[model samples]
Target: MSQKPTSSENIVNQKYDRCLADLLVKTGVGFSIGVVASVIAFRRRAWPVAFTTGIGSGIAWADCDRLFNPTRGPGVRIVSQAQTPESK
Candidate 1:
């Protein structure tokens, strides 16, 4: 029988899944935009423009992946603690 996964393992799995989803979304958007730009460039006879744009967009896509999928500890942190006024 397989042993149950520990809480830490579960958290890591969740982070991996979230990271994967983020990457997929970023990549999908980048590809769709690149395809449309290519079509337009072809119509306009601007092959060089399309090539440069594709390169720039690829860099942006990687940046998005890095921005959203942080490798640092489980991204949870308390921003503030509520405080109550002195008891009446």
Candidate 2:
């Protein structure tokens, strides 16, 4: 017997799934582009494929990082409350 997943668990699972999907799509597209470039422009060199694939993976990683840590992303500001003299 197994219990149902909690809300937090579901959220985490969804995020993980999204990240995985992004990784696959981005990397696959990059690989395809790299193959074409290698064949047409790079004289069938292997580096273009590897380089483009790496770029795709890097993009996916940045997107995943933002999803997991929204506040830590670019242009996010954190504000702190000021204490009153009476409270202090």
Candidate 3:
């Protein structure tokens, strides 16, 4: 029988799944836009496809980084519970 995963493990798995989904969606959108832009604006050049794809991948990477390390992300703050005198 397989044991159930711990809370921390579940959280990690959820984050991973979310990251993967984000990457796929973002990259696919970028690729589609790139294809359109290549055909219309860039004279069917291959560079636009590559450049947009890279931009999409970079955005996904940043999002994943922020998700995995919330404290390290910009404008993020962690607040601890205030201790009362009675608890001290």
RMSD (CA, Å), each prediction: 7.0, 5.1, 4.7
Q: Which ten residues in a row have the lowest lDDT in candidate 3?
A: 79-88
What is candidate 3's lDDT per residue for 15-76, written digit by digit as tens?
Answer: 99999999999898889899999999999999999988889989998999999987988787
The residue ranges of model 3 lying beyond 4 angstroms of the native Cα positions read: 1-6, 77-88
TM-scores vs. true structure, each candidate: 0.45, 0.85, 0.77
lDDT of 1 by residue, 1-88 (tens): 9998679777778766866676666556655666676677566445645565566557655655555565533575545446545557
Per-model C-alpha lDDT, please? 0.61, 0.93, 0.90
Mind giving the per-residue lDDT tens digits that candidate 2 earns over 55-82?
A: 9999999999999999998899877665
- Predict model 3's lDDT versus the native: 0.90
Clashing pairs for predicted structure model 1, backbone only? none
Roughly what TM-score does model 2 have, to 2 decimal places? 0.85
How well does candidate 1 match the true structure in TM-score terms? 0.45
- What number of clashing residue pairs does each candidate have, in the order they appear? 0, 0, 0
State which candidate, 1 or 3, has the greater lDDT: 3
- Please tell me which model should have the higher TM-score, number 1 or number 3: 3
lDDT of 1 at 49: 54
Query: Could you tell me how far off, in angstroms, the CA of residue 16 lies in candidate 3 after the best superposition?
Result: 0.3
- For model 2 the local lDDT of residue 12 reads 90
Candidate 1 lDDT score relative to the true structure: 0.61
